[model samples]
Target: MNEHPFAEFIKILGKGKKGSRPLTQDEAYRAMTMIMNDQVEPIQLGAFMMLMRVKEETPEELAGFVAAARESFHHDTQTISADLDWSSYAGKRRHLPWFLLASLLLAENGIRVFMHGAEGHTEGRIYTRNVLAILGINAATSIDQAARQLQENNFSYLSLEHICPKLYDMINLRPMMGLRSPVHTLVRLLNPFDAAYSIQGIFHPSYRQVHQKAALLLQQPHMAVLKGEGGETERNPDMDCLVQSVHYDELSEENWPAIFERRHIKPEELNPQQLAQLWRGEFSDEYAEATVIGTAAIALKLLGKADNQQQAEALAQSYWNARDKERFST
Candidate 1:
């Protein structure tokens, strides 16, 4: 029998914190492969999950973890390459972002949107399914169904479990243990069609790049990785967000990962009734701002933010500013 890290991993978990060791990015990657593939037993698996959650992962550590996750899907380079402007995220939280609205808005303007997520993994407000219903869109569309939706509506919601069972299984373990695991690093970065351009958001600031590298490993045409608010110390809601936009050609460059760092965002605070009215096409002051901001982002990326970065960036900001006043306000 091979003397695998599986036993040691179990020891780390079951032994209850004698002193946890930080594995190198490479080592973490290997351990992830073992556990994800079931080469490790359940007890050890649970132990490793707890220790990692407590420690809080580092950039390199998470990078490797996400790699193992994508591999577990036995995901092919082909599926990931099916489209551009591919955007994915973890399950929706208390506030369902206008992501679906962003999707519909983008699609209506000719951008193909592909989104994938899981249900009941996170304990929070249900957003994806309910919001889609509000839009007259069926949330449970099959991959084919979703693909059709994308073709017709330019928006599709895919179940991560259907696309990649093991990866989905990994994230589900989080709520189960009452701890958020490193697996989330995998979920936010999943690019089922391996899109050339992707926009992803992560709750934990530390693991944002895990999403970025996951994109690099596949050599995307362009990608953006962002960190959203909602860890401990909720008061400091990540004002704007940290965005890294990269190009396939620049992947090997020193600053291949260009930083669109720490944008100061005063995201509007809209109540449910206000939000509902906005969705129903009632148009609110904030909805206009939201749409312009969203549109400018997609437009800026399409125009190659690297070369004419400043002008493109300003255009993006102006978009939201103008809309905040009139975009949706009826």
Candidate 2:
């Protein structure tokens, strides 16, 4: 039994209390050791998550948390070979998961993609890997294999289960705790590609700065952080979606942050609620025209195929609309 984990755990919970000092990295590390090692009781674990959520976490504060969580796992994906690695893990409660489809399209267009998340949805399994399987992409059975496949095929996926045993262990708590901890944030920052073009969908707006700093730390090539359908998943709501991106254009590893685009399309263009209700039933309705256009535009800009987003956005709408119509007819 690790006493350090328990000691840090107490400090976190205690700090969240009305009268306690904010827990530091040293403190969080000590606590997480016990929780990750299963030395803490369920009651204590739940209390810790709730208190931390109530108090909120800072990027600096999470440095220790992420470092500890990362120490326990090692992954190597040899299959994905692309300039950009697409990743997102802010779990979605509703709406059709467009990320899966978007990833497939990205892969089809020669961009390597990777995605992972625990089981979500009422059925305990609305996840990206499942969708990929449905689409005929085989997930990597091992870390090295995933790396090999990425080098060979340009895309691969490793879930929390594969990358970090302790974080995967926390899936037990999502049901009981009813809220996510810092692990959700960790998933987005954990890079699969050593150096590649990157696009990210973040859960919170505040994470923009966090991700920028993280990109610098990781020494990534380019990264885009988007607000994403007003705090919802990558559903392309047809109502709105805001994309904030950071580009690492050259030898310098500095982050270039910008609001790539503001999403203000008509919800009527796509009956989002209806699409969610009809998933797995049939491939119909051709999806939301405006949102498809917008997403395609971003994709175009990220590829550097277009000089400006305005032109890229226009092209995305028209190109996707035409493609959707063709797919539906066939």
Candidate 3:
């Protein structure tokens, strides 16, 4: 029997150390497009994902995969054009998602922030979707619904569950495979709405270049990738942040000093309700506040709302202070 079509793709990846090579841009695009369209067998798909994970993906390969994924999305430019695309895959294990508040603060100030994430694939962490539900924001089930929400609230969340279930299914394969696949990395780079600005968070430090370079390849007008707190695009205020970004097709890096002199200990138990209560001004936490402000400052600078870190921080604080306390009181 002739070798299966998918088997050829796997063989291309798994051919031995000296013989195997990274996929070209076009090949990567075609491979991922096939996977997205469910033309590949399940066993082959697993093998392909793990092989790419082990080898690590090149920026070209990542860009091509993102191209295919974006093409698969049925986004309408006429209806939705988000200013910021935030991807949240790594859940918070040490603290609640202060970045949720950061995104809301930006939205409150007229930035259209579209946030996407996947949940429940990994154990022992609280994800954005759960926290959003507690705060009375339901995840959008379709692109149109998300557009409507963004129109009304200036912020909307579309989960990988609906935005691209095939990719979400690939992410969930982590439990069965006992290791994360390439899906985790590329999913964050998927600017589903073709937003002008995108932000990414990575748990590992080295993946910063991978994300930045991939965004450049994808022609993202403005993007930032940082080593975020618990890897969810939420800044850790206790530590200085090195932001790798692409602005107008040029790549650059900046280091922002930590907001605090002394590092604060993470909360022992993450209380999701505190997210809403804090928004309602019924609760206050110093560490959480800094995270939100710091995270928002980075976004503010990326949006050109501020010229420098100091200005961005001041703007972020003002936005935070001016937020509607009762918006999520229910």
Candidate 4:
């Protein structure tokens, strides 16, 4: 039957280590397009997923996958626009997602932030959409709804469940496959709305460069990837962070020193309610506040709201101090 269109993809990936190599960017784009369109056979899909998982994805492969995903979602430049595209797929295990507050701080200051993530793909961590609901923001069910929410609140969390069900299915395959597929990396790089700036957090430090390099290949004007706290883009106050970026078509790197000398121990229990409480000013935690400020400062700097690291932190603190405390409580 015409030699099964997708069989060659499996062959390219499944070939022995010596015989196989990374897919060209164009090849990656084509392969991912077929996957997203649900045109591959189940057997072929499984083989492809495992092969990619074992070897990991290269920057060119990742960029191509992102292009394919962006195409599948029809991320029109005319209709979809934001100041920052934030991806939060790695759920938090050691901390309450202070990154959420960082995003809010940016949104409060008139920066439109588009946040997207998937949930329940892995266990033992709290996902952003869940905490968002607890904090009184509903996850957007469609791109149209996400756009409206962004217009109203300057921030919107669009769940991958709704944004790309096909990708969600692949993420969910974690249980059946016993490992994560390239879908994980590809989803984070999607930036489906074509925002001018994009921020990403990776759990593994090694992938930091991979994400940054892929953004360069994608022609992203502004982007930053960091080994964030709990892999959620929240800066860790106790340790220095290295940020990789693509600034206006140029690649750069910067290191931000830790804010605290003493490391704060993660609480044995993570409470979602604390997120709203912290936002309402009814609760105070030194580490969490620094996390929010540090994270927001990076974003502000990337958005050109501040010229330098010191300026960004100062501006972020001002934004934090001026936030409407009761906004999330009600």
Each candidate's number of clashing pairs is 7, 26, 0, 0
Q: For residues 63-96, write the lDDT of model 2, one tens digit per residue.
A: 5565555555554334435565555454444444
Lowest summed lDDT across 10 adjacent residues in model 3 is found at: 70-79
The superposed Cα distance between candidate 4 and the true structure at residue 186, in angstroms, equals 0.9
What's the CA error at residue 101 for candidate 2, in Å? 2.3
| lDDT values for all models | 0.56, 0.55, 0.90, 0.89
Residue-level lDDT of model 3, residues 124-144, one tens digit each, is 989888888888888898888
User: Which segments of candidate 1 are over 4 A away from where they belong?
Assistant: 1-5, 8-21, 74-96, 229-238, 249-280, 295-299, 302-330
Better model by lDDT: candidate 1 vs candidate 3: 3
Candidate 3 collision pairs: none
Candidate 2, superposed: residue stretches over 4 Å from native: 1-5, 16-45, 76-82, 88-93, 121-125, 203-221, 229-237, 248-289, 299-305, 314-330
Q: What TM-scores do the predictions have?
A: 0.71, 0.70, 0.97, 0.97
Global local distance difference test of model 4: 0.89
Native-referenced Cα lDDT, model 1: 0.56
The 10-residue segment with the lowest total lDDT in model 2: 250-259
Candidate 4, residue 90: Cα displacement in angstroms equals 1.1
* Runs of candidate 4 exceeding 4 Å displacement: none
Q: How close to the true structure is residue 131 of candidate 4, measured as C-alpha lDDT?
A: 92
